[model samples]
Target: MTIRMIGRHIREGLKNMWRNGWMSFASVSAVAITLLILGAAMVVALNAEQLSTYVTGELEINVYLNQQVTDAQGQQVAREIDQLSGVKSVQYISKEEGFKRLKKMVGTQYASFMESVNSGNTLPVQLVVKAANPRETTKVAAEILSVPSVHNIQDGENVLGKLFSFLNAVRDVGLAFVIALIITAMFLISNTIRLAIFSRRREIEIMKLVGATNWFIRWPFVWEGILIGVLGAAIPFAIIAYGYQFLYHYSGGAFVALSFPLMKAGLVAHKIGGILFGIGIIIGLWGGIMSVRRFLRI
Candidate 1:
């Protein structure tokens, strides 16, 4: 509690670590390895979720108009669809524009084939609808289908459904893996701390015989555990920060082919640093408490 008591605990903790050099190294190594795995997993999970979101946000609904629909009727339909709930924006593409776009897509080799069609630009006028919320694309598409000039709709419902399902599965699996790793890490750390304290059992008994309070005897080992945790987490934190920065820069801002963008390196590092530090402290304290309690049998 007092400064002097804190200083004594820290000094004793350092002495204990030195006294059992091999065991101390093992404990620190265990902590570092566990935290490193956790940090890497966090990075992957965060980026995967972001990529899923980016792809979802690009989804759109295409409403094709009937061949006989007049320009005025098409404009009216666009106005009505834009007013619908969950609709973000609606742009009308005339039949002529659609034909030009098709021609551009087919390239020079197929230009003659498109020109041979005798139906005189049979491509239907279309209203491209963007949803304010990606999850509501189906709902917005349904509303657009009810509009007067809308002959049909292509909302990619099946593809979006599969995408959402895959993302959810990834999230669930990542969560489960993290939980398993945490449990395993705690178990290993607790056992290592117990072994470290077991070697000092005689000293603890001697302190008790000399009328030292249990709190006084326990503080040093607790500090030792905390130190191990902090030391283990430190290297992983540095590695993650530097590695992520390199990766972000190397990938150039966005992976255009995948339609995914990495979060700013500084922001990701800051958040992950806080998380690793907090977890380190908690695991250290927990291992200490468990080890001390088992040894003291109190």
Candidate 2:
């Protein structure tokens, strides 16, 4: 369509909103609530994944060697672990080193008693094992268990597994909630546009009876919905933008230190802003078309 035609559609759309002030206000309110929920959900989903990843990165396995395994046997076992597909690194700690570490951990009060307990009998030579992927740690440990000298593994990586499941559930549930709310927002917007169409029913009928195509009649209401959606999105964008920045600077970015960081404010605003506007535009366009559908049939 020509620029002039598009301009006219925009003008007529804005004029309809001005004439139907209360309904327009209600539509904007509905969309604003929907987008606000959307913004909150986005933040949660992003952070849940971040937390999961942080935990995964920190996860590691401690592989204990058989006390009878010779130094040569321990060296071979370390090589085997290093060769494992998912192994990130292998660090060998001899019985002497382990006993020293034990004393350091148990502290000076217990140091005298720990010295009498022979290092070879009390402490097993072991490998500190890290996996390339956190999720594969269990598998890596199991494979290591099959080797000749690997005696045991500790912690079983239970925490990392539970964390992955919980975070995934959070993301999935949030997605479903956002989708349902968006559909609800569309209906709210469409209903408001329907009222606007009802007020102009006679004009629509006359346009239909004449040579005006469906596209021509649909344009104004479509623009009306688009305008409503855009306006609805604006409030939430401001709230999310400033609120995220405050949390980033004032609250130290994330709930956890080091491994976990809330996405930066500039990045959050950029991403969330685009998403909010896109949802707004789609809801408006669809609501407008749906509202105008019955009027076009006349």
Largest TM-score belongs to which candidate?
1
Candidate 1 error regions (>4 Å): 19-22, 48-57, 67-73, 83-86, 108-119, 132-135
Which residue pairs clash in candidate 1? none
* lDDT (Cα, tens digit) per residue for candidate 1, span 1-298: 8999999998988887887788778777777777887888778767767766776788889899998886777888888888888899998898778888888988899877988872677777888999999888888888888877689999987976787788678767866776676666666667666776777888888988999998998898788888878987898899998998998898896765774788788887887898888888788778878888887664
- TM-scores for all candidates? 0.84, 0.78
Kindly provide the TM-score of model 2 when superposed on the true structure, using C-alpha atoms: 0.78
Best by lDDT: 2
lDDT of 2 by residue, 202-238 (tens): 8888987887887887888899999999998998999
Q: Please, what's the RMSD in Å of model 1?
A: 2.9
**Model 1 has how many clashing residue pairs?**
0
lDDT of each: 0.81, 0.83
